[model samples]
Target: MRTIDRRPLALAGCLFLAALCLAPQTAHAHLVQTGFGTFYDGVAHLFITPPDLLVAIGLGLLAGLCGAAASRSVVFALPAAWLAGEMAGAFFPSSLALPWLTTVSFGAVGVLVALNANLPRALLVALACGAGLLHGFVNGSTMVAAGTDRLGMIGASVSVFLVITLASGLVVSLRAHWAQVAVRVAGSWIAAIGLLMLGWLVRGQG
Candidate 1:
């Protein structure tokens, strides 16, 4: 009796495994789902998105540099403005995408942080509000395209509140000169990254 050929079976199994490994996976461009709900998804989106996270952190650092009073204002104002912006974007979705706005937002904030600028309370709040509105609007439009609900935006705003509160509080609590300098260093790095992103954007457009 002829022995069964085991080599052919092994080859088939290897090819099947390779095919499985090379299979394409589904990707979500805008929303990130945690299986909990849209709310958590929104929170996850804020942390995962580089531009949004960078701007949020930069704003927190700037507010902390300003003073405790300014931080307080930012902690509330930013989230509120973000929610409002999201609402507007959801209601009036625009086809135009402004990726450059995000780069500029974080770049400007990062520069301010590096400078350790002595910004007035009003100016700080204004900056926070402006960043919130712009970023939130972009997020809103993306979420709409992704079929995510408003709850996600609210969740994102909530995350922003917590992030700002913690980040600003940490900076305000630091008494060491070196610690402050370190924060500024981080700001400079953020600015450098933003510049790099801007260059890439220009290259892509070109």
Candidate 2:
């Protein structure tokens, strides 16, 4: 057998080791860095997080189904409640993790949307506020753990406002019965996803 060239193999191994040493360390999984600041990172976080996005979409769809007044109320109330909850959470950090709360929240909102339930304005606002508080607390705790600035929370709340405004506004403008039905169909899909996630969670726990 021909003798192997040990020099090339040694060089390759050395380069690989060097590369590993130079590699950047892993960042926090929950926080996204946009190179623009913590604020933009917070803004991006809402879009990237599935549970939060689903809740926002469910709330928006429900508000839209109810009408313009409900949409307007949710548009403002959700973000405000989110900010308040974030502030509270930041002041008093907790180790409690309630992933199930998010699943239930989005699931219930989806059910209401699919049913086309004629929820009163006050009730709709209350639902939006409740969801906001729960999600906001989670986000706040996450931010604190990551050592992110509070401005990120403000950015996240702003993003919530934008998302709700867009989603609810689009639904409110729909006049056709079929179009409304389509919205309800989307709600059903959201509910289905929530159920699937809940099942997975249960399975994992078991």
Candidate 3:
């Protein structure tokens, strides 16, 4: 039996993740892109939006750092809360606070990941639920404005859950010390980006 060396593969993946986290982001950019006004559009929109993509990555990293129990909690809480928020947003869609809320959630979760928070499972679930609500509301509001229907919203919610679950699973599967460290490094990069985004928002407002 031959054992394959997997360290290089892990290192490569970590580097790719770090690069993604460090990519430049426009502070005033719209977080949602118009899709085909169909269910698939919802899925495509989630992947195409940079802010949404990063938020999912941040949530996944945070959950992964907290371990399997926390990960499971996130998998459930995120989608459920998002669906609830989506339903709410479909009815009440105007939001001036979306940008600020997004930056805060991004920064807070990044900090937790960087610190490798070992929070109680309940706290992790609560955080995931809260983040999901904010994320889902923003997504939902955007979709509604784009004239998408409930089916589209459902597609978006499903995509959100799948993305977060996959990212968290990827990080949690890392068993090597260096791989774990890479996840933390990615978190730090995310936090720095969030801070920069906040500063940009402030400057624009002033």
Q: Which runs of model 1 end up more than 4 angstroms from their true locations?
A: 1-29
lDDT of 1 by residue, 26-121 (tens): 223568879999999999989888888998899899889888999999999999999888888789876544666778789989999999997999
Local distance difference test, per candidate?
A: 0.84, 0.85, 0.77
Which candidate should be chosen as best, given lDDT against the real structure? 2
lDDT of candidate 2 over 72-113, digit per residue (tens) = 899999999988887877888665445667777898998898
Q: Is candidate 2 or candidate 3 better by TM-score?
A: 2
Across residues 3-120, which tens digit of lDDT does each residue of candidate 3 receive?
Answer: 9999999999988855543443232323344445568777777788656677788888888888877898898788889888878877897543367667778788888888988888
Candidate 2 local Cα displacement, residue 161, angstroms: 0.5
Q: Estimate TM-scores for all models.
A: 0.84, 0.84, 0.80
**Two-way lDDT contest, 2 vs 3, winner:** 2
lDDT score, candidate 3, position 15? 89
Candidate 3: C-alpha lDDT: 0.77
Task: Name the lDDT value of residue 163 in candidate 2.
Answer: 90
